[model samples]
Target: MYGAFWRILPGPWWIRLLIVLVIVAIVLYSLVTWVFPWVQELTNATDVTVGG
Candidate 1:
């Protein structure tokens, strides 16, 4: 979260910024690596079972 970055940002702005960027990059990579494949499979699946 940006809130985490803010706490770490008081010192050298570049390094904190790099950390934040890395975190965001990792999160985005995770979503692409995990969530996206699941979503594609679920949406593409023909035998989906939904309940209310």
Candidate 2:
């Protein structure tokens, strides 16, 4: 899968590396800004002792 992605990207090694980094940053930012919050809401987790 990753091999296919690298093959599809149009650039030299350094440019491809930069593009991969940008893609990773965008994915991480989206998870942090949206996905994680939605998951947390679904789970409804809270801090509390399970037993005495």
Q: Estimate each model's TM-score.
A: 0.63, 0.89
Worst 10 residues of 1 by lDDT: 2-11
Provide the lDDT at 18 for model 1.
86
Assess candidate 1 and give its TM-score to the true structure.
0.63
Candidate 1 runs further than 4 Å off: 1-5, 8-10, 45-52
Find the candidate with the highest TM-score and give its number. Answer: 2
lDDT by residue for model 1 (16-51), tens: 888779889999999999999999887867666896
Model 1 clash number: 0
- Give the alpha-carbon lDDT of every model: 0.83, 0.94
**lDDT tens digits, residues 1-52, model 2?**
9999999999899999999999999999999999999999898577666875
Which residue pairs in candidate 2 collide?
Answer: none
The deviation in Å at residue 14 for candidate 2 is 0.3
